[model samples]
Target chain A: MSDSVLRWTRPLAALVVIFGLWQLAGRVWTFPGYLFTPGEIARAWFASLDPETGSAVLATTLRAVAGFLIATAVALPVATVAALVRPVERILEPYIGFFFALPKISLLPLLVVWLGYSDSARITMIAVSAFFPIFVYMFAGVRGINPGYLKVASNVGASRRERFLHVVLPAVAPMAMAGVRIGVAISLIVTFAAEVVGQSPNGLGRLIQDGFSALDYDQMYAGIVMFALIGLGLDMLLRLMTRRSPGLWGEGVPA
Target chain B: MTSPSHVMSTTTVQPTALRVEEVTRTFRRKGRNVQALAPVSLSIPSGQFLTIVGPSGCGKSTLLQIMGGFDTPSTGTVTTPAGPVTGPSRDIGMVFQRATLFPWWTVEKNVAWALRCGGTGRREALQRSRELLDLVGLGGFETAYPNELSGGMQQRAALARTLSLEPSVLLMDEPFGALDAQTRELMQEELIRIRQAAGTTIVFVTHDIREAVFLGDRIVALSGSPGSIALDLAPDLPRPHTHEVMRTQEFLDAYETVWACIRDQASAREPGRSERAAEQDDQGESA
Candidate 1:
């Protein structure tokens, strides 16, 4: 088979085989209490279609995406300006490094104490976790730009605004996007952790926590499956978006 | 200037296109001042194709940048007929050694953007870009991205982008320096043709002696570090140069003269090389 053809079919074939064996084993023997059969998990997943459960899924998605966007919006401009100005960079470095080194999840309890067990606190945790990677990548991207490009921009008499929009923005876009990809992944992880540990009213993480406490292994596995699907779906969508618009990521990277 | 295309009629009294008055550059590196260029002065007439040649680290690129107003000279001034240069203007365009085309843009859009900077509207900029692309022999590659093109073709696209501004004078810093030998020669020919069509005054900097001779009406050689003009020769080569002209005696003699000038500077600086190398090592350690 061609490489492109095998790329989809091979992994898919392994998944099918694995699931078939798992179902056979579960039916033949008594598995652990936490281990639910694939059939039972599917039934639980279908049962999760009620509005309350649907809102749990929605809560998780909103938290992750909003947090990622907020981090990106803040990081890109901050990094660009910081990299361009020496005094700003010097002032920002210590703060950036300190925050980046901190475990953002540890702040969730303190934030919950301050803001209550609310979306704001959870989203803040996710946003704080997402900021560091985005900022670092963008700062390096702006700094790594070829001085020659700026010289060319000046020689052509491009004004400051035009140069930023046309030269600096496009040049640093891929770096910013890479940072965003990582940021989104971090937001998803942080959102789940914050949701579960903070004991908020509703979220996929809360649904999983409820299932575990009730000894409803099927619902727990189904919630876990939903997270995996959401992750895969998001990654596929983002990759597709970047691939579709080659102009945004095309040509060569900044020197 | 129009009557004689070959351009050695100093008696014609063409108005000065660009004048450099005792310009020098000193860069501060590692808490020490490193003088890149000594006080250098030269006057170029309108529509003249002048080439500046020197060895590496000879500060030829620095001179070109100063002329283009991309860098300020430590002292002295550069003036065009319109005004004294405070910074880069639309009247003076530049092409760097590396093609600085926005990778996101296709060949045509790159040229169009330069035109758009001059306040040309969308349709007209695209139209002018098409013409410029064709002029640079990039007729069919308009929609192709910079990465898809070869080094020579990218440089051609860069040249087209700069030319779109309709600048009266163009400053190029080793524009062909990075290309392979064959591509470099071909680009040299392309530049000669483009200069003829546009009649734009040019100051082309290169380390290659033969390239300096083949494309220039006036060749100025700068010696090693703290470089100043070592020799200025105006070889009366035939106009509308072709590749075949490379075989002519006029071309060969001009080549030899520049080659000798550069060779002499190399040996003269040979004794000071070890001292410079030690200084560089000290700078590296400090850094």
Candidate 2:
């Protein structure tokens, strides 16, 4: 076999084995109505490539992206401030701890009540869920920098702005990227959960919820497969972006 | 006692490049006061290579830090030609035992960044970085990240970065200590070449007695616990030092003298004569 084909053989074989067993169980065993056969799920997935399903995918993607952007936009500066100032960290510690500890899904009802059943409530919930992880990672990254680097910067007569731009930003970038990766997954998850629980106008989550209600197990499974693929695709995209700057990934790539 | 007028007259008679006037340092750790360095005064002339050697925990680093203006002296002053050293200045550059390069930056950028911090223009900083890299024999490795370089190469790049600021004083704390013996020797030779070319005053701190004699025009050995300078000797070795010079009798004698001074300091801390003899036996086994 060719190198590319050889590389993919293990994953492909694993997929075939798992799906074969799942299909056999679905055919022979008595299971719940929600349980779907692999063939049925594949057919439904192909069928879901219509304009209606496309719109649902777009809606969910937009909500997830928006939540991710807003979460990072607010979290970056706030985390930076908290890391630099001990008093600010003290002030925010209890609230961040409380929110981070609470189950974010439980807040969906309260968000809907406060912000109404509009897209705003769903985005807010996703943003809230995604914010803590990024903030915590960035805070730790900034705090954990080697004091030697700062000493060298000062010795070189670096100004406050220069120190932040050259030393602090690059030093903390890897950890912040790790946080962003986590935030990407959390944003997607919170968006989907909010859609199902809040019954939003259009999304993959709503499609799955409606399919389940109408006893269309195949369509629900198709939506689930799409969710997994989207999540994986976004994660891979993040990894590729970081690979371009190998230093942020702690690798010594040749120029 | 001599009046302030008499001190001023003495200071005026001979101008010093760097002066440490009774500089002392004390730290409070876990509610206990620890005196790291006692009142120490030293005056170094321009373009002199001075090395401070001591045993572990003798606060050689504390004294170096105080001299570099990275730490404040408890009740004394360090003054340069410009004025009192209150904070870190561009005139003095420091190199640590570890390379401490910003891993994210390529070799050229790391050097260039130091120049940039000193308000050099971007293009000029980069141009200067290329020249310094070449000077340090790292010209082709300009685009390589720090981790790609060998340990010796990393320290060479760090030296280039420190030199980029055009500092008149270079303070190094065991800059080649982490390298293997062969690499450390090569780095020491490379340093002598660079020092001659730059003509910067150097105050180096190391625990290695041989390294102290090899590098310093004058060696100052410090005693342990409330560290104070115990012995100050000038080796009087010829300039443009080479590997063959290490085999010379003068070099061996100088090394022996420094070793004896350090041993004496260590043995003085021992309680009894028998214990001191046992310590000497242990040293012999180690050698």
Candidate 3:
């Protein structure tokens, strides 16, 4: 009980100290137009809570989640196929390295030209940005399964489908989940980036962009704060899910 | 340590459960052919406990893997009563050195998973797994994840999973080798009890001679550069084995015989083993 209390209190204390110091500093100095006190940011967030914040939150969430799901759907099967068939791995080898090294954000213009400055382009951009991390982790996960596991599967006379579903799926789940966590975070980042630079008309990215243009520092801070909160919420949700589920952990000995 | 039946699994007139005919294993490593095991032939009778003992470099584990059809012999065949061993089957279950229990699952789920592979329904399989867990002394640990359990408990869960298949033969490759001494001893006793209840033929592989003498009705010792059976003894030790049995004259004599055979192998160099090939064999993957 004490440990759990301490867990929250320590981080909360640190955050309070940082924010309090920032607020005090703002009061002592004549700040620039682009900067706002933490108090002013909170007031701005409350004022925009109804339509502005809600719509932006919804738009950003939809794009990020859709892109994350799409990326997972593609990366998982591709990784499995690569693990199962040696030739597929050989074929994907060069491209996996090349695409991983290349910055995915640079493809936004090409995507904009192909799909237009719409949600589709933004969603596609998020997925493209998220795919490499998911694929890299998932590929490593699938390839690194213990040979003993497959031996046990066959020894039990499991059919091909059963082996895939029971052994392969569960064995890769922990690592895949790790990939999904990173992918989800990447998805939100890409969504914000796509919205901001690509000049999307909606989303938290747009709110920040508009705030910057109007010299409303509080609004920009509010948008940034909301983005951070959403990221924290999603991460907490994923963590809660892993803890509740039994099999999505480090396989006893990484075997 | 004993449960009930097959306490002495008398060697004579018992039908053969597993027959390995002149089996040899050769591994091709970096364009060089490495012979892991020389010709090995053994006939294991039904419901008997057969332990294969050897030094670390010996192909005891390789031989056990072949018995389970996890690996194929380079030059021979392993036959069971059903047919020649061509592939892994539920009839021949295997328990590995590492517990290898799926970390994502509870103990019950891990055991039920094996039954599920054999087309059992989920609820029924889970109920049956409870019974198997009870048999392995994990009665209340059904909902516990593998990681939550100790090394011994994990092995118990693993054994329960293997037993869920109701295999005719159990091929164990150093299942208790990773456990501490006390846990290893405890598992050994539990294994004897479990084997009695299960009444399946078991081919357990380990490098411990004392373990072999304690557990097996028949013991096969493999040692030296390339693996071959150095000693095969059927000791008439006390049944319903306990630690006290280890102090018996019969047990001591059997242990002495097997130890002598292995000691001689290490002391004297075998013929046709070039120093380079022997070094490669020592560092080879088979063990």
Candidate 4:
């Protein structure tokens, strides 16, 4: 195998070894009282994914996705407008900084009181948490385009729209990707936090909360593991997407 | 006084290529005005290769920058076919001291981008870029990135990118100055060949006397501090001037004359211009 493949193989082997140990610690060792194996977690995961009955797993994924999409939709336009206009950017800058400084978890009670203890409060919390990082990343990307690139556009007699489409937007795409990755992380974190605080009807966070309440340690660990794995998957998908966009991340970064 | 309208008429009547009239540059550094170039005037006819040679900090690069419309002179004006050089014009292509290729682009893409900017379709641009890359002896390396290429190759790609525009006036600021001696010579010959083929009126800036003499139809020698044209040496050497021309007695004579002029200016600029003048006065009286 090539050197790159060899490097990957070593990491893959280490991962397998770690999982094998985890399985041994849980199953083969026969540690009783809520200590379940990977097989048990898998079985539970499959059992909780029935579409007709609306599984706990499905509800969890849906809630997170819904919150993420809402946050991104609102944040993207706000951040873009803030980046473009100087006065607006100044007006929003202090507010954004203050909000980012304030912990979203601390505002859970206020969010519940205003939006109620339903999915609305949970989603609002998730959006609030996810929104800032995306806003920051998007703004930085837009502002970071070199003056020289704009000069190039002007020299070439490009119209304002042409310059934006060709140079400005393309230059900011990498930074936008960076923002998206950060947003994804925030989305997952806030999703879990929301479930814990608001106790949303369906979600991994709810499952974990219920498991912990009942002292079902294995179920809580399984939910935690599932959350981490999904987040990792999301990050990988974003990385691949960024790599594919030639106009943005193609420079210096290896395929 | 040449009427601006008359100048504009003659230039507009037919592409005048490039013209700088009494173009002086001044800088307000630390609340004091330093005149880099005194009022200097020159006209470059189309298809003529004009090289400006001067000592370090002689504002040769400054003059080139003014001509390329990269900087504005404090006083006087520059007139080109594409109106007053208020900003960088597509009709004028400029290559700086360093190759500033977008690191994200492949060598082919970098060259192709110039054409893409010029409104050519991507397919056609890619084809033209490949031919241009081949012209610069970067053939078969289209897929290679800028980082993969050597310094000389990178400069050549930069040259290719500038030429891809097919601009009427090509402004190069020491394009080959950063290379090894052998590479510089080879690149200079390649540039001459390319300029001849493209019929580009080039304003090449250099500190090397031989390189200037080898390349330019007319060499504009600039002086320091308040940079002004000290000499405009027109080499009437026979056509198809090659590297061998540098070995000729005529070439050597011209080099020596240009060197003497540059050396005097360098010394004058070293110890304040006033002190140099005083020293000159003492030597004159003693003689």
Candidate 5:
């Protein structure tokens, strides 16, 4: 076989073996209804493709994306300012560390109470959760720029704005993108978790909860599969964007 | 009697391009004051290439930084024809020991970015960048990234970027020090050519005596911990120097003089004879 074919064969074989074992176990053992067979789960996943579930998926995706955008818009400029000014960094350091250390889920009840039982509450939770990772990574990126680049800028008589645009932005973009990738995953997870815990009116998390209450095990499994797919799809989309514009990020492709 | 026009002609004078007036730099480290560069002074006329040579820890870099207005001297000033330099100005450009090109930019973009920062329009900057790349012998590699090029090529690109600013003075700190011996020699010749073409006053810092001799119109040898100029001599060499010029007796004598000065300074800092002997014995056993 060719090298390319051989490279893919091993992973394919392992997946096939695992599915076979799962089917065999389903036949041999008396498993709980909630513990679904792979075939049954696949069938349920296709069956859940109605207008209602599709809207639920859209609702959840929109919330996650909005929350991520909000976090980026707020955190990036704040982190840039903090990184540039020592006094601001000193003031924010302790509080930033404290909030980052605090479990984001623990604040979900307070957020719901403050913002009421609306989409705002869930978004607030997701935004707060996503903010720390992106902010910290961006701060580190700005601080970690090679000092020589700044020297070159100064020597060439680059103005303050020019230095920020040309030197600082390009240098920190790759690291900031790394943080954004993690933030995207975090935003999705926190949005879904907040939906389930807060009992929001619409979303995949609510659908899953409704399925459990209605004894629709298949529907719950389908909801989970959709969640995983959405996260994976968004991450891949981000990776593709980074690859397309290698100059902006400095690193050409994700490893 | 002389006419009024004759009097005006006689009175006209050109100001010095760069002047370092008794500059000194001291740093505070671990609650102790450390003198980095002692009082040193030099004047560079316009369109001259002056090279500064010294051993490690002699504060050559500190002095260069001071002259470039990146760092302020403790007790002296660096004056150009305009006035005393308070900070980094557009008229002076610096090239570091390593190529400080932005890795994200292609070779053409790197040079163009410097021009853009200096207030040139985008299209004109790019056109100028292409011309500079050709001048630096990197005509076809404009699209290549900094990491894609060899050390010599990267440094050449860096030189092109610095030149893009059209500065009156160029301050280079060991620009080709990281290259191989052959590449360094080639770069040295290329630099002389560029200097002649551009007619910018250059203050180049290096530890290599031959490099100092090859490129400099005047060579300044600095010595000691808190560095000061030990010797300042102009080598009597012909213009448009070549490899054959390096082989001549005059070049050898000048190289020997610089080498002896550095060697004597190194030995002067050595400990007593018994300690030196013991250190040599340890090295002998290790070898």
Candidate 6:
């Protein structure tokens, strides 16, 4: 536990320094009302977590989770099948590439038109945005498995399922986890963006939009600050989860 | 560059082990036929260690690949009384020049995977894998990933995995060809020890003459394109050949004999090659 804390000390210290500078600037420049120091943001952030306002954060978190889960469900099997079959890769890669090339924000209007200004549209956008990175990373990782390992497995009499369960999945997990980590950050960002564009009933993005409409700069800053915290928290959670996953890091010995 | 005599004397035939009759392979590359192996014939008695050594581009690997049933011979038959070699056989294990261990599996799991695939129960297979690891001097590394091991250790894990299948014949394509000198020597010794313990027939291929000589009961020296066996020489040496035997006159004499044939082939490939034709002429006359 101490070791893990040490590992994060530098980043935590940097966070402190940034907040300290922001607070100092607010006090020195007589910009207290507008600048809204770290203390003010902290107070506001905690207050925003009150049962009524907290529901919005909860709704946004659920949306992000649903979007990411859907993306994972779609991407993993597609990536695995694509990796195993050359023809599938040749057929699907161009279309996937085309989708990835498009500006995700450009699809916001179409998504709202199709799914309406509800949670569905926001979640759908998030899923679509996160899908490509996970797919591409996982596909490459699976396809890059050394043929020698397969031959060894085949020569030994491993059924196809056994080979997949014991070898292929494990080999691809680290690369896939990296993609998942990236996708998690992307999904959160896209969810926030979707909420802002679609004018969803509640979310950090919607909250920020509402503050902007009311000309409440401090509230807008507070929403942005919360957004950053949520993103950081999710990423740290993923890193911890990956570190614990089997076949992830060099945790146990070979046997 | 030199040949070491095969020191083992278990040459008793154990029926038809492996048979290759007029096996030919050709690859169609953009409308041209590249004959890799042309109408080759060979056989190995059960339990004999036959090493194939040849010049580059001689299709030594192509032949081995065919024998392992990775690719079909364009023509002819590879008949083993045990059964037909279709795809890959659980009875025939293989180790490549590169150790192809799954980087994700722990050393023990990798070995156990082989056994489990060969129909051993999970618990028993895993236990057997541990024993195999112990045999390979990796007893304590059962849970260690391939990435953590040195090249030699990774290859050892590969050997253990191959052995876990309890294969009748183990096909190795220059398994230690990628290692440094010391590691190569250690691996060669390790292979000999493992083979002795397991009693698996081995068909190992290499370009290194010394390795071919060191490991083989009979060394098949193959020559250039349209690869065919140029010489089939049995090494009549004492059992359990050690490094000490490598320094003896008998070893030097055997090395010289093999090198003469290999060097002769090497020179013959070059244009304006000066002959040992005169030497052959004199030797022929003396004979």
Q: Using DockQ, give the best candidate's number.
A: 1
Say what the RMSD of model 4 is.
7.7
> Across residues B1-287, which tens digit of lDDT does each residue of candidate 1 receive?
22234354557877788999999988787799888889999999888899999877777877887888877899999999888888988788889888988888888998998888788999999999999999999999999988889999999999998888778788888888789999988899999988888788899998788888888889999985787999999998888888788899999998998898888888887565676664563332112
**TM-score for each model:** 0.90, 0.88, 0.91, 0.79, 0.87, 0.87
- Predicted model with the maximum lDDT: 3
DockQ of each: 0.63, 0.46, 0.59, 0.21, 0.43, 0.37
DockQ, prediction 2:
0.46
Candidate 5 lDDT by residue in tens digits, A1-255: 688998999899999899989978999997898888788889999999999999999999999999999999988999999998999999999999999999998998998789888888889889999999999999998888877789888877789998988889988988899899999999999988989997788999999999989999988999999999899999999888877654568553111
lDDT of candidate 6 over B213-270, digit per residue (tens) = 8788788887755677778888675556776767777666666767778778777775
Q: Which pairs clash (backbone N, Cα, C closer than 3 Å) in model 6?
A: A253-B143, A253-B144, A254-B106, A254-B107, A254-B142, A254-B143, A254-B144, A255-B142, A255-B143
- Looking at model 5 chain A, which ten-residue stretch has the lowest summed lDDT? A246-255
lDDT of 3 by residue, B1-287 (tens): 12234544454467778999999998888997877889999998777889999877678878888888878899999998899999899889999988888887789988998998899998999999999999999998999988899999999999999999988889888899889999999999999889878888899998899999999989999974468988999999877788789889999999999999988987675555566765555446433
lDDT of 2 by residue, A1-255 (tens): 688897899789999999999999988897676666788788889988989988988899899989998999999889999999999999999999999899998999998999999899999999989998999999998888877789889989999998999888988888888899999999999989999887798999999999878988777888898888888988999898877776656464222
| Superposition error at B220 for model 1 (Å) | 1.0
Task: Write candidate 2's Cα lDDT for B1-287 as tens digits.
Answer: 11122111212433466889998787765697768788899998666789999876677888888888888888899988888999988888899778889998899999999999888999999999999999988989999989989989999999999998777678998898889999998889999998877777789999999899999988999886678889899876877797678888889999998899889988887545465544443232111
Q: Candidate 2 overall Cα lDDT vs. reference?
A: 0.85
- In terms of docking quality, how is candidate 5 classified? acceptable
Model 5 clashes, total count = 0
> What level of docking quality does candidate 2 show?
acceptable
Model 1 clashing residue pairs (backbone):
none
Candidate 2 residue pairs that clash: none
Candidate 2's displacement at residue B212, Å, is 1.2
**TM-score for chain B in model 1:** 0.91
Q: After superposing candidate 5, which stretches have Cα over 4 Å from the reference?
A: A1-38, A213-215, A252-255, B1-15, B270-287
Give the proportion of true interface contacts each model preserves, from 0 to 1: 0.66, 0.72, 0.83, 0.30, 0.72, 0.68
Candidate 6, residues A1-255: lDDT per residue as tens digits? 988998899789999999899888878887745567788878777666666556767778888889998998999899999988889989997899899899887898998999899888888999999998999888887887666667776787778798888777776777788788888988988988998888888877888888888988756776877777777888888778766545454243232
Off by over 4 Å in 4: A19-55, A70-89, A146-148, A243-248, A253-255, B1-16, B24-40, B53-59, B98-113, B116-127, B142-148, B177-182, B207-213, B221-227, B235-239, B245-287
**For model 4, which pairs clash?**
A251-B104, B36-B227, B37-B227
